[model samples]
Target chain A: MKMTKLAALAAATMLAGMPAAWAEGVKVGMITTLSGGGAGLGIDARDGFMLAVKLAGRDDLDVVIEDDQRKPEIAVQLADKMIQSEKVDVLTGIIWSNLAMAVVPAAVAQGKFYLSVNAAPSALAGKGCNPNYFSVSYQNDNLHEAAGAYLAKAGFKKPFILAPNYPAGKDSLTGMKRFYTGELAGEVYTKLGQTDYAAEIAQIRASGADSVFFFLPGGMGISFMKQYADSGVNLPVVGPAFSFDQGILGAVGQAALGVKNTSQWSKDIDNAANKAFVDGFQAEYGRLPSLYAAQGFDTANLLISAMNKADVKDADAFRAALKEADFPSVRGKFSFASNNHPIQDIYVREVVMEGDVITNKIVDTAMTDHANAYVDACKM
Target chain B: MSALLLIEQILNGLQSGVMLFLMAAGLTLVFGVMGLINLAHGSLYMVGAFAAAGAAAATGSFVVALVAALAAAAAAGALIEMLVIRRLYERDHLDQVLATFALILILSEGTRWLFGSFPLYLDVPDWLSGSVTLPGGIQYPLYRLAIIVVGLAVAAGLFGLISRTRLGIRIRAGEADREMIAALGVDISKLYTMVFALGAALAGLAGALVGAIQSVQVGMGEPVLILAFVVIVIGGIGSIKGAFIGALLVGLTETLGGVLLPQLFGLFMDPSAATTVGASLASMAIYILMAVVLIWRPSGLFGVRA
Candidate 1:
């Protein structure tokens, strides 16, 4: 009985010694795709975000992770559960734009802060933008626009553009055309989750396009690249970073090498925060950090910075602190636009084989201090 | 499109059709012989891909990988039949579906545990990595042509086995009358196990071949599995010839529809709008064909009237 009492006293003392910011215990609910086809992206994001929280070593912060299963309805249900039963102060980590569209508005409207680690849907950047919601990742169009800028600068006049037939796919093409001042030889929208690209490749070969721009993400990208390489169509390929990220690059292998992609972050970025993130991530996960991981790590640090400045319980004060964006972002200079979307530089990255491992190296800046076209449409 | 491009697209369609036939053949055979609905067939496909990928990565031999895929899928099928599937033979299709669905969850999670979340890489052999020129000067991937040849060879081999071999005779007899075959001193359970394993090996072969071209990861088999089911339904369940024909039809329709529909729509609407509509309709083309076939003949093209 005496030993039990002594142990309880010791535990109480240890708890009291923790930082005061953790006293109330900031509860963060993370809902991301943890299974299905796109599981790699979510897994990386979760690992990177958790790594940041672990490094911070804050006893007061509590995180609850849930799998969205890449389903919009399921994400909405999980968000509802997190907000009502879990009573989480913040919600973050949605990987797909469709799920984000379903979950974010309602969650933010419920007076909970939402820090998106990825998936900045155009709707959220426009009239649907909410003050309580902030995007740590690029707008859906930003990277595509960067790719377009790179292609235009390279003086490609006739390019074949392709994407999966979905909302994001349409946005990608629109983003590319926004910056591209050249004629499109062809614009094809393949079925989402299409595995075989033989028919499309045949058309591409026939179209007389000097270059190709595609936005097939995850397994779709892998299939397209392998088939493209095997088909021996030697046109220069450019795409958004979603396809060429570290998570799926190995599957793509030498086929992806020398292909240019656009992104906001790369492992080879010259910055102290990025160096720490890349090194720490590789040390922890034994793999190079992808752009998704960088976004997730930055998201956690951003929340921690806000938590340090103001208590989450004080809603207005916390909101103001978060708006200040006082954190060492992995991207080096991340700032929130008026609509709470990120305004930062997007870079062109070329996939290069370092020894045997396929990864990306930053080549050039495509866009500087870039903000989404929908920012002005946002009332807030 | 030019004539060369059209010819290439047709070849692509034929290639995809043949791959689908490889998957559909086993499924149709299993369903026709066993009267069992096995949703876990896709899991077996995934198993084959992972086994091949793991083997190729370790040994750097495509032949070893192919053999490993076949052995792994066959072994998994036999084990499942002995442990869990044998008991379900007397149960209804609903029970079989539920049990097999549980198996899918178990297999997927188990695979994730064994192979981490990231997709595994499987390289095409150097000899099969480049393109081959066709009669019309259109370049097609040699690997895809190889897949087509392999699939057709398997189809012929399956035909020979069923028509010429004693085991095939037993399998056909068992499918016709299980009790009669058992009473005739044939080992019914053993035959069932063999058939299941054979089907699994075929599925595995398809998985391994496709894995070389696409990402080999968990849940990779589901899309193919769905298409295989469609093929079997269109071809007529339990009919290998039907599966072959149905698979080819589905493949041709899917590829041609994707290309032709957009141009057809472009005559009326803007190119972007036409593409959106065309792609959407193209995805539904195979299903639409299935529905049309079913409407015309409820039992499918080759399926017998019950």
Candidate 2:
């Protein structure tokens, strides 16, 4: 009788372990600028994605994260490791455009889904748009296009444009000029990743232009705004999403006030989802959420929503679901285009001192469901 | 460009130059007096900014923050000298470089661990927050003007101390002949520590002052540090006066080149082409300046050939 009882217990234990052993865990890998000058944005993106993943509570999915250190080589290495060794099904979270260009093609070659949380270069939006590639964030041109729309409406007769001398910077100018039908007074390009802007500002003051447009992101943006304010140039300065985000407001401070820009979502957006995300983020990180964080949060949720649609079993089906635009975005009613980039309303915002913090409040809607002019160039 | 615009550009150059001087002064002093090359100098600058930001946030007084910045940087410098730097003093420049580079990694990571990878903001004093009118109808930032004043004052103080005081005499003597000073019964270690502290204090002051205008955060000092390196290289390492001049030259060249080059190119080419070529070349201007200086004066403008 004792032997019979032992056999029965062993059989039951085996029965319970069979299904557990058969379950395959899905792997997702993320690489980001987790150190150096751009670390703040990368950290925000990381946190937002993590929060979404935690909220989803997926038993079958496991996520791995790595710091690219803002180096394309390092990002590429991480991508290779994720694809070859880790066998990750999805790769995401790129903050620098150069780094994104390096990693995205690698993921595409492997037939893995790529979700970009930030760094929307126009090349990816237009000529290089891939079926496996999707930008959960705005196109590099979207915000600039919005600025252009605002400039057109403002009836600025002659405008001077400025940007860092790089591919994305050129795209910003091209994006702006597309919508803005004004006399081009002049244009100046500062060095990419430049820390000083006095000379450029001096030239701008001298140019006799009616207004100025610029697209500088991260540290470059902060430093330029400070110097521009210092130079006391009376011409109104304008740019896009990154130029006046919460990530840099503290440094720019009062200098940022009266500066207008374009963005899809601001901290002051009157939406329940955004309100909850902002409050929760501040409570967790002790700062306001930038657009980077909003997109990061949305990216994770969108991924989860697509996974649910495809039941996490079919990668092709999941990609199709993601491309179908079936998620409620924190930014009021948004969707993805056929090219896998966002199609949404972009708002013109002016930086103002709101209570203890500096934030952007929506002044007007600049563009709606705006397909980029370069869309025809994209075969997709 | 109009004459007014040129004048405005010059002022901008001056502002950039002064900021560079603030960084170079401390670095040059440390190298000259201590006979030690410190790669972690930038780390101290970062520490000072972080210290100031923390203190200012807590007390809501910029004055206290400035004081705390000095104290924190000095304490950190003295501690480093006592623990790590003292060991590397007898080592070669390569060893010193490697050790200090390691210190940068440790300090940067430690700062991030403490600050949690977010930038802290430092507010300019209400009194120094606006723009002041310049001679050419140019309004420059008041905070920047204050930086110029502080930098000049420090330069004056340093010169006075080196020429007029006993401690300065000892420091100069030690720099010339360390063994002789020790043979004469001077507490050489104490003197070295004091010099180190003094250099650290200058760096701290710079960090604290600049923090008000920029974000006070981890890795903030690296850019300034690189510029300082360029300054000392052009000025001749170990020469304070040379450092000041070299810094000014670099600052002006960078600022003015950024503005003038594009326009100059614009005169010949289309706006897009001019902007691209001009901006790229302008960014390279200072490095080119350094190379030219090195070609003419291999030992640096003020460097005494060993």
Candidate 3:
């Protein structure tokens, strides 16, 4: 009787483990900036992605996460590990453009699908486009262009523009210029990662500009906003969503109030899908989701939707299924452009106090069905 | 630019110089007396910022925050010295480097675990919140001017402590010959601990002071740490006076270069191209200045030949 009971227990354990082994379910490797200066952005993305996967209630799926530490070399090494050792079917989650540039091209070349939650560099959108690469996030310049359009519509003249002296910084200014018709009063490029902006603030005060457009991200943005507020430079301030995201808004505090920014997503986006996501995310993480978090959630849902249609082992079918973009997106209506970047409306958001908590509220739509400048360059 | 703008720029340079001196002074003293290359000094700066931010949030008093920063950093320095760093003093520079680098990773991760990833807020006190006008009709933040004044006062106090006190004599003696000082009945270990704590306190004070203007977050110390090392190298390693002069030079060069380089380039090129070129050059100016100083004096401006 004892032997029979032990055999039954063994059989039950084997039955429980058998399906996961037989299905050969999808394995995903996520590499993101998880520690150091801009860690808040990456942490939010990671939490959002994990929350979506948990909500799916699938036990067969296996996900591996690694911290890139915001370094391109480290990201490359992690990508190699994920591809060669872990044998992940899909790779995603890089926050910085430089790291994305390093990891995405090489990972996609190895025939693994790369879904970008953030860091949509123009290079990959255009000449470097690949069939396996899809960006759920906006192209790096999309929101900046929207801001430019908003400024133009608002009749703001004599704008001063500034960004860090790097590729993305230059890209941001160029994107703004693409839509803004007014002559810039002054254009300055501060040092990347510069903490002190007193000299630059003095310049801005001296320059007779009526408005300021800046693209300083992460800690640089925090420092700039604080100093700008203290400097009493009361001219209207505008920026892309990078600086004004939900994660850093508290750190910016009262300094960011009334500032106008542009993004493809906001918590107050009036849609059922968005309401569910915003409510569910806050319930799960105990914090409001940032734009990066929204992108991450969408990326996870996109993968899950494709997996329902085709097995990742069938690469062609899987790729086609992903391009279909059949999943419900939090952004209301999201479709993939020919280049695999999102073609959706971008909105202007104002930083406002929502009962002692600093957050963004959607004011107006900046652009509808906006496409990137590099789409024409994409052969895929 | 107008003369008033240039004057304001100069003041900005001075303010930056004073802050850099606060960091460089402690670093130079530590290297000078201990002959220990502490790559983890930046971690202490981070600790100070975190402590100050936490204290200020809890107490709502800037004075309490300042005290907490110094005490936390000094205690942390002493504890680290007792546990990990003491074992490393007799080791070679390579081992020291590897150990301290490990400490940086451990401390950064530990801080993250305790504080989470978000940056903390540190506001300037209400009394120091606004700007004051100068003689040239230039507006400068009063808090920044306070930083300049406080930093200079600390420099003076440090100078007096090192040159005119009994503890200062013992420190100099230890620097000159550790064994001889020990033989003269000084508790060398205790003295070492005190000196390390003092240096750490100075670094913490600098971090806490600067935390008001900058985001008080993990990894905030690293950029300042690198600049501080450059200042010490330019001023001559192990020389406080050298660190001060070097820091001022770097600060002035960095601030002025950002303003002037583009204007200078505009003379020969288009305004857009000139701005781009000038900004790039200005970023490189401080390192270039350091390289020039090294070429002129390989041991640095005040460094003694080994």
Q: What is the TM-score of each candidate against the true structure?
A: 0.96, 0.92, 0.96
Clashing pairs in 2: none
Decoy 2 TM-score against native: 0.92
> What are the per-residue Cα lDDT tens digits for candidate 3 across B230-303?
99999998887899899899999999999999989989998889889999999999999999999999988989
DockQ for each numbered candidate: 0.71, 0.47, 0.68
Of the true contacts between chains A and B, what fraction does model 1 have?
Answer: 0.76
* True interface contacts retained by model 3: 0.63
Q: Among all windows of ten consecutive residues in candidate 2 chain B, which has the lowest summed lDDT?
A: B134-143
Sort candidate 2 into its docking category.
Answer: acceptable
Instruction: Give the least accurate 10-residue stretch of model 2 chain A, judged by summed lDDT.
Output: A16-25
**Residue-wise C-alpha lDDT for candidate 2, range B1-306, written one tens digit per residue:** 778778777876887787788778778877877778888888888888888988988998999999999999888888888888888878899999999899888888888888767667677777877688877567667777787787788788888888789998997787778899999999988887888877777788788887776667777788889989999989988777888899899989988888888778989898778888888998899999999999999978988745
Stronger candidate by DockQ (1 vs 2)? 1
- Would you list the clashing residue pairs of candidate 1? none
Clashes of each: 0, 0, 0
- Provide the lDDT at A61 for model 1: 83
| Residue lDDT tens for model 1, A147-206 | 999999989999999999989999999999999968999999999888999899888988
Residue-pair clashes, model 2: 0
What does candidate 2's lDDT look like per residue over A181-221, in tens digits?
77877787877767667677666766789888999887678
